[model samples]
Target: MEPTRLNKYLVDAGVCSRREADRLMEEGRITVDGRRAVLGQKVTGNEKIFVDRKPVKKPESIERVYIAYHKPVGIICTSDPKAKDNIIEAVNYPDGRIFHIGRLDVASSGLILLTNDGDIVNAILRAEGQHEKEYIVKVDKDITDEMVTSLRNGVHIGDDRPTLPAKIMKMGARMFSITIVEGRNRQIRRMCEAVGLNVESLKRIRVMGIKLDDIPPGKWRFLTEQETSALKAALV
Candidate 1:
């Protein structure tokens, strides 16, 4: 068996992300063969490992799992409280605390991510970075050229700060597609409301490099291997 750093091994085992493993290492929360192990210490699988005094099982080399769900409107994004239309209940996924990479409001719907990898989840959702999310918005009134320009330039959405610059394209007389790198809560709705347009429907069509494609609302599918690799590459 090849020797590897304990922290790296722990991360690969899905015990924690690499950063969390490093933090635990610094806190002296790991041991190998009953000896306290340092952060960078190397070990082989034959040695016993414990995290927080509990033996760490040898993680099965199961393929990393990822899923994409086309959430329907009226479903909440949370798992707790067990609402009538919670995302978790809708999926009927097996018991595990899988989390969405980002959020969609209870009134909105579209592409949502479900993953077991904490590292991937953190990389995609970190708010300080730039990541474009595209949405198809239907408004109550016909959108004008000036409205499209205003959306692209940025507008005050009754927030303490102005909305970020965005890319907007006319889809129909009363519908448009908008892409914005910054995600604020109910941001698309608020921005449209600020410009005298009431959003009748909003659906996320893309997140960064991933598109919703033909996925139907209230349905989910496993990510193809290529899709998984592409997403991981985009994060880096």
Candidate 2:
């Protein structure tokens, strides 16, 4: 409740981390009391603050929300309204402003989480790959046991380093379910490509312990009480 630094205030507002707050301040993107904020400036906890002209209100207690969206293929996982077919518009959520927790690529589809609660975002994403993300994928060609084992062992997907071990389950001739802790950009596709398989389609079915279950494509629902509690416990 005391006076807080601009960076800390931004973090509390669930906008960004203290370091990112400093960068935004330096970029002249943040304003306090109608003036561009300077580095290390402190807000009196009552002065008005804005980031890119959007007001920032740090609440002592904030209502938390979590959504399980069945993101459709070709929809982007970004808050930028300028983007074509962005998730926010696709979901048409009438609730207050919120952002997606993680991303599901434009070409890929399925369960993606969105929330207004910043603390949960920080807690879950701060650990990065510590959480689980499960996907069902279809490759262009038949998948062999060797390929599955190789994928589980780890593959150098043209990145600077190899990926960590992933859980693999063969579902069909060309279909497989894989779970990974880390989420590099287009990681699943890249991993398959490394082993000479081209991905035809991919769908993320789960994150943490939450699942898409029977949620139809393009529909989203608020996480249930038990689902939310389990997610928090998993993060712990």
Top candidate by TM-score: 2
**TM-score for all models, in order of appearance:** 0.73, 0.88
Which lDDT values do the candidates have, in the order given? 0.79, 0.85
How many clashing pairs per prediction, in order? Answer: 0, 0
Error of 2 at 176 (Å): 0.6
- The most accurate candidate by lDDT is 2
Question: Residue 70 of candidate 2: its Cα lDDT?
Answer: 96
C-alpha-based local distance difference test score of model 2: 0.85
Per-residue lDDT of 1-236 in model 2, one digit per residue for the tens? 67878787776666555655777788888888889999989887788888767887665544667899999999998765567898878988774456688788899999999876666777877889788899999999999999999999999988888999999999999999999999899999999999999999999999988999999999999999999999888877
Residue pairs clashing in model 1 are none
